[model samples]
Target: MALRTRAVLVHRRTELDELLDRHATRGQAEFFLRTRGRTLADVEARHEAATSARSAVAASVPSDWALAEVERTDLDRFLFAPEDVVLVVGQDGLVANVAKYLDRQLVVGVDPEPGTNLGVLVRHDVGDVAEIIGSLAAPRAGAGEGPFSAVRCDELTMVSARLDDGQELRAVNELFLGHPSHQSARYVLGADGGAERQSSSGLIVSTGTGATGWCASIAHDRGGRRLPGPTDRALAWFVREAWPSPVTGVTMTEGVLGRGGELVVTAQSDRLVVFGDGMEADRLEVSWGQEVRVGVAERRLRLL
Candidate 1:
């Protein structure tokens, strides 16, 4: 018999659940919201919508497939198989949060609250997920252009940061290297061409997938040109608030990275950190003399 497909539904807590968790009771939660001139009814309604969306997704999973539901916080502990199909049922950020943890597993991003979420990553609606999942399972004739093709999984670029100590982290959106507290960080920034010792707020290394986000803002602030697209197979780097002192020059502030291209940073501070996809809790730490290399990851996000 063939191995059954496994679907892992990823989700996060709703606001109402958080309120109840904090207050310890529905009555107390409602009262607390009331005191702030906000009604519990609104939160309740939002929770109901989310619940409905979750139910729709659960009901749509193929009966023959193995199913599991994972809370966003517990993803670190969840043991995913190589064949698992990941489903993210939250905002676009949730998609980014989970993508780094996966190794080429097909991700179906479902927008739980379509009415409110911009959902650039979580673009599919709950109603359409079953069909999308089915399509991904079915073999195709070409690059999802045939009449039999019901879905197309766009391969998004990703970045990886490998430390000299062999520690590594991947990012679907971008990677941040600097002080965890966003303070002045000193480092020797370098590439294949040359290296420079500099002091700055931090550095943001982004994939084409992250061009419209933090990278876009940085590009705009510096009067730089627009960044690469989501599938551009290149990475962009920007130094945030690079302090131009007599010692720290600002010439090496921004650039693009591709295959055989990488940005190396040698830590000049007592403590520096490398984190991917805005997840600070999951990070790699480097000491005063350590170094990290950031470049495009070998793996890509197969978005269904």
Candidate 2:
């Protein structure tokens, strides 16, 4: 029997037309276009390239596949198809767009962390909330089917007092604690019972993926030499110069920590912001002697 397959085309419009004209083997396949600026010919060329790539990938599989591009408003329509396999293209934006349309347990091709727009959208849509680094003492069990079945963080470590059953957590490029409004924040950094008070513009904790982006960018601006390892190279280039790094480098699970661990945070500030996977979580007031818990979530993004 011929396997039935469905593919979604996500790219610039000119590219979409070209892909449909060239790679579309049958009329049943769907093509979703995401074109911005380009002439008709340019779009056609892009489509041709994309379609050919898809065909090559599909040929190895046993299932029959169709192709199409999705409209912003019609995501729900495509998502409802239980048998359709949606393929997203482009860079970071592709991951974000794909998450919005996914209601089922579909895999994507990207990293799973807060810094990523896709991670934020997935966390928000699924309703998995993270607390301060010290607050995750026990997993809270509740009724009802969760929006997401699992949450997974790649190349991240968690340090928490305790973790609850079914409440998943993970670390990413880094963890940032600061106020959006420019202000000096005070915090204590240490493991176990020992801690010290330090004041600085802000504090940020980064994993390997976050090293290159905002974290690395800030280091370069401050005249800090590049740190070695895959951890520092991932998102280091994406970091902006305006933001500063954490004052004290408190060692938690340094040197290749796994998915689940804990990083204790105690700080003094009227308002504190916690960023994971590179997105903001609900804000909290960091008072003296108060602890923020951190951990990894169970959901993982399926990247194509």
lDDT of each: 0.86, 0.40
Candidate 1 lDDT tens digits, 212-289: 899999999889766888888899899998999888878899999987799999999999999988889989998999
Q: What is the TM-score of candidate 1?
A: 0.92
Question: Model 1 Cα displacement at 192 (Å)?
Answer: 4.4
Among all windows of ten consecutive residues in candidate 1, which has the lowest summed lDDT?
Answer: 142-151
Clashes of 2: 85
Model 2 vs. true fold: TM: 0.41
Taking all chains together, each candidate's TM-score versus the true structure is 0.92, 0.41
Q: After superposition, how far is residue 7 of candidate 1 from its true place, in Å?
A: 0.6
Q: Stretches of candidate 2 above 4 Å error?
A: 1-90, 93-106, 109-173, 192-194, 218-261, 277-289, 295-300
In candidate 1, list every pair of residues with a backbone clash: none
Across 35-146, the per-residue lDDT of candidate 2 in tens digits comes to 3333545445545654554444334233334556664334435553433444443345344334423434333332222233344212221112212111211232321233
* Candidate closest to the true structure, highest lDDT: 1
Q: Which residue runs does candidate 1 get wrong by more than 4 Å?
A: 137-151
